[model samples]
Target: MAKSKPVLNVALVGYAFMGRAHSNAYRQVNRYFTDCPYEIVPKVLVGRSAGPLAEAAGQLGWQESSTDFAATIRRSDIHLVDISTPNDSHFPLTMQALDAGKIVLTEKPLAMTSAEARQMAAKAAALKRPSLIWHNYRRCPAAMTAAALIADGKLGTIQQVRAVYLQDWLTDDACPWLWRMDAGVCGSGAHGDLNAHLIDMTRFLTGLEFSEVVALQETFIKQRRKPDGSGLGTVNVDDAFLFLARLSNGATASYEATRVAAGRKNYNRIEINGTRGSLVWNFERMNELEYFSFDDEPRVQGFRTIMCMNGGAHPYAGSYWPDGHIIGYEHTFVNSLYDFLVCLKNGTDYRPNFSDGVANQEVLDAALLSAQRKAWVTVEQSQHFAGRAEPTRVAAKNAGL
Candidate 1:
């Protein structure tokens, strides 16, 4: 008989869009990924209202539900706490869970600013607890393959990177205001909510940090009816943002993110050009990677769309289906959850950890500052902390200029 693996209980807070996606991952991951070293059990779901708790719990497969997040965090039976709340709530909730000695996982753009993120990172390090930020896009098989190819020097001497994440949900002028539109809750509109993913993906694929940034922001719709239908309120967040940046590897890049880009729904795309070859991937076609290699025979030289459904080469495809049968966006979250469990089983550190979160937050903060000053700003405002992991040569030069 085989020995049974240990089980990890999860307490998830919030039950909105991200909450639904995360719940689906927790419920389905164990069923599809039987080889994961531990079984994930959704122990409790936390929400602000008791009225919807029961319904959400039933739909999400949680064993129980709670109207109080603090009480949920204090439960000794809970082994992991997953936070999907808004920006303002992240720091306090995360710190409380970490203080209780639970594994902490948070949705991206770690906190409202780099200072808050740095403090959380320090606490996690001091406690020596495994913490992760949900930069789930990195788990997409095509994206992972891109990272592998880049690491293998297939895209040698990277020169330029271009990325954009565009959505059309808020394009309408009549769209109601929500927490995401409030800077107090969401930090910086599309810059943090959407661009954070691209920034993290940029760092993950290239193994480089942002050196400096020059940015611009726009608020297309300045006011809208409140969700509560009370009255009109100021829409203080940017509807669109564009920035130019230099990476520590001496590569230049352009990034654009917006919620008001008409006709572009979830069209997150990335193109990287290098001395030896080039690569491109888009979330719209989530399972394909377009490749062009200079080493290819002249007669056959062109971009080839490589289907990444092959389980052998892909990261998380084998467990689902045979080659050519592709997965979708939700599977990325499942893969991330599986990876987190594997790390727990092996007692290993999770990638894109809090340190990476802090690094990404630094870039987001610098972009906002650059937009404010109308001048180029170094990403590492405090080189003393930012320069600890990566060398500060690029940042130093930018600061002296």
Candidate 2:
């Protein structure tokens, strides 16, 4: 009999929304995706609060819990360090793990600033270890299928990309201001929390890098009561953001993200138009991809809604469910972890690496700059962190400088 492959020990930091989502993924990925070369075992859960941390560990089926993140990352038994902590801690924890020569998996908006993100990416590149940024939306079956189609020339030369992510959680003035409202903790509010997803998806589907962005940012409710009813706290970040972008592929992109969209609940939608065809996706209706092909009959050339079933034709879909059976938001993390595990086993570079995280952060930086300056700003020319040279800002040829 052959010796069994060693299981990959996993340690997760943070036990809230994203923490639980990733924990569930670790628990479920191997059970469904049997082809996964290494078994993933939940090793440790780390958090600041002791009570909730222990409860989260029990609920998530981790072997143990700890408040010291440094100890968790330094443990010799843990093979991978998953950072699901707040945005402010992502860079420090990830940097420690990388310096320790451990593989790291981190939640998005990899750092508070593009310069920080770039430094982290540069470190990972230097170490040549497996470092993945958790841009889980890219793992959606519909999005992945659409990306393949675009890559295969099925969409021809891409012309435009429109992406919007809207949620109603902050619609009410009575909604207590949380860490997400703080620029110090959450970075640029909805732009980092929500728009980052669309920006990454835009790059994922269209294979384009943003050249420049013109953006407008707004803070709808300026003041809100604290969650603990401690008077009122001023909202320091934008509740919503809108931007127009030019992509390196010569495609145009329009992006909008809002936390106060009245009727929308977790609405994430994207549409890509190319010379030959087009594709669209909505998270509200996760299982469907609407597509249009000009090659079809002219009379019936309108978009056709294609139900995405993972059973046979789709990648990673066949393993878990049959046709028309939908997977939810949590499953995206599972798929992402599965890919990470496979890459670990095969020594392959995973998609949406830290470099991708830095790139996405650069776009976010450019958007913020554009909003502040009230003009088009090129992403490549923005200054990310302290002591970094300014990025080169070149006017588009069409702009007629």
Candidate 3:
């Protein structure tokens, strides 16, 4: 008989929206995917206050809670640190975890700036530890199906890509000014919160890197009363952003993100055009992928929707529901956590690591520069000017010049 492997003990930091979402993933992954090599158990929850942290831990099914992050990371027993903290703390926590030789999983927009993201990436590369950036949107069924189709050459030579992520949470004046409204805590507003997902999805589906961008950004509601209602605060970051970009593969891409879109509620949509066919995906209808094949008779050419029923037929589908059954938003985090566990078992690097985080930040930096300069800005130029190392040669080569 073979010796059983040990379960991976996870210490999660932050107990808010993302914290709850990730904790649910840790609980669900092993329950559904019995074949997973390493079991993930919620070992600890870390936050600012012991009271809130303890309450969150109990509610989220954690075995224990701690107010000190350094002490949690220093524990020899904790195998992984899942950071769902605000943007400002991502770098410090990730760097400290890497120094302590623990695996790290951080929420997206990896850091406050490309330079900081680069430093974290370089440190992780030097230490050779498994670090995953949680771009959970890539784990969606439709998005994964689109990636598979494009990779299989079903969609030949990608020609263009367009993405829009819109929401109405901040459209009304009554929406309280949270951390998201403060640039000091959240980095850029809608661009980082929303466009980061869109940028990564485009890269995932098309396997292309953005080379240049011409963009515009705006702050529709410049002032809003603080949550305490004591006074008003100025909105320093853009409420909306739009851009035109060129990919390394000579493809054109357009992007838009806005928190002030009145009717749209968490609408993240993507469309890809290629020489042979095209694909489209929308988060609102996550279980379906739309495809258009030019090979069909000219008169019959039109987008056809395919239902993504989870089972042995689809990647990761068999882990959960039977065929034709549906999954929801939380499942993406579960799938992502499952992938991290597999990588840990195989001693392999996970997808969308810190380097990818830095690359995404580079695009965000370039978009900001374009918006400020009122001209097209090259990503390389922005990165170089910002004093960060250029993306690795492997990234450049895989981008398909």
For each candidate, give its TM-score against the true structure: 0.94, 0.94, 0.94
Tell me model 3's lDDT, rounded to 2 decimals: 0.86
The residue-level lDDT of candidate 2 at 213 comes to: 91
lDDT string for model 3 (142-247, tens) is: 7888899999999899989989999988889877677776776677889989999999999889889999999999998888889797898878778999989999
User: TM-score of the candidate numbered 2?
Assistant: 0.94
Cα lDDT of model 2 by residue, 1-401, tens digit: 74576788988887889998999998998788878788889989988778988998999999999877776777789889888877877877788888877888989888888888988999988888878899998888888889989999988999999999999889899899887887766677889999999989998888889999999999989999998878999898899999999999778999999999999999999999999999999988777799999989999899998777757777678877777788889888889888888887888889898989989999998888888889999988667322112212111111211
What is candidate 1's lDDT per residue for 1-401, written digit by digit as tens? 86787888999988888999999999899888989888789999987677797899998899999876667778889999998878767777788789888999998889877888999999999998888999999999999999999999998999999999999888997889987887766778899988999999999998988999999999999998998989987778789999999999899999999999999999999999999999998999989999999999999999999999898889888989999898988899999989988887788988888989999999998888887778899987623222112212221132111
Q: Flag regions of model 1 displaced more than 4 Å.
A: 382-401
Estimate the TM-score for candidate 1.
0.94
Clashing pairs counted in every model: 0, 2, 0
Model 2 error, position 49 (Å): 1.4
The TM-score of predicted model 3 comes to 0.94
RMSD of 3: 6.4
Error of 2 at 199 (Å): 0.8
Q: Relative to the true structure, how large is the alpha-carbon lDDT of every model?
A: 0.87, 0.85, 0.86
Residue 96 displacement in candidate 3 (angstroms): 1.2
Looking at candidate 2, what is the lDDT of residue 229? 72
